[model samples]
Target: MSNYRNHFMSHIKTTIGELLEKLEQHNWRHSVYVNEPEDTSIHTVCFVIDTDSAELENDVFTPSIAAQNGLREFLPVHDLQGVREYLANVGVSGTPEAELFAIMHYFKWDTYPSERELAAYQ
Candidate 1:
């Protein structure tokens, strides 16, 4: 079982590395979020790759329409499709979201409610 797990993780890492390279080639900025739910009932890891880019438009900037929609059209269709299928087969799940709120909710940061109160305490 350990050998199988090692092989599975290795394959996933290799696939993600290849996909990141492809994204870089197209000059797209990307973020990868991985969540392993604390609930034992949920047996899969949630892997999301969010990508974005800006386009030059009449001296203004606009988001890439293709990327906004999804990677299907922005990237070669087969590239993303193959990755999705591979993940599904391995009992892993992959998804996309417009924002990173899902994973951000789990993060804790050291912040003060007001700068004045923090300065006084210091």
Candidate 2:
């Protein structure tokens, strides 16, 4: 792989690791997944916190609502913000979808676009 690719991969891995560590300290369990809409071009990464401890009436709860109820904190506004900022500094677009795609690509996750396609968003 090229040196630039290696550097980007290394940075993303480190950023994720640190974010996981912080989440763990807050007793938040997390998982990553790909959300592939029917329109495949819009596939995006999802970072979810375990909600086992959250109360649900009729199973209705958004991440923000769960966080308000003492569930795992909404990572996007807190931890993931750092990742977004890093992506922006590296010339990636600031949109959530763009950040998700960049994270998915760097982490070698499922549903990521090709390197050339991703580069176009930078």
Candidate 3:
């Protein structure tokens, strides 16, 4: 990975860490899968979260108010099939140029909203 890619990944990891911490505190569990770009592909970051249950069908993971606001920039997947399709279409490997574009498309970090913005999102 280039220095630029490494830096971006580090930033994303840090943001993810903070989000995970908040989610865990609120009874939300998550899993993240990252596919590093290869010679011709792009990086793919897949984030999946669930509630207290471990079972795929049983777990009812709804984004908390804070999480929802914080993740406003991401393309939220509502169905398992959609998530699977996204992963399948965007394989884990890509060239540096492709990866750069991938960074702009996937695994985006989000921002927290103020009280008024929060109310609007709700």
> CA lDDT, every prediction?
0.28, 0.39, 0.30
Residue pair clashes in candidate 2: none
User: Which residue pairs in candidate 1 have backbone atoms (N, alpha carbon, C) closer than 3 angstroms, thus clashing?
Assistant: none
Ranking by lDDT: 2, 3, 1
List model 3 lDDT by residue over 1-122, tens digit each: 21222321212222322332232232112333233213212333333333233232222343342243333223332222232333335453223343233333344323222234223222
Q: TM-score, each model?
A: 0.20, 0.31, 0.22
Question: Which is the better candidate, 2 or 3, if ranked by TM-score?
Answer: 2
State, as a TM-score between 0 and 1, how close model 3 is to the true structure.
Answer: 0.22
lDDT of 3 at 40: 14
Tens digit per residue, CA lDDT, model 1, 1-122: 01122322211212233443333332123333233223211222222222333342353432233234322212232333444444445444333320111112222222212323223222
Query: What is the model-wide C-alpha lDDT for candidate 2?
Result: 0.39
Best by TM-score: 2
Clashing pairs in 3: 37-94, 38-93, 38-94, 41-93, 41-94
Give the per-residue lDDT of model 2 (tens digit) for 3-96.
2223212111122333433333332233322233222222222234334443444646444433343333223323344455566566666554
CA RMSD (A), model 2: 13.5
Per-candidate alpha-carbon RMSD to the true structure: 16.2, 13.5, 16.0
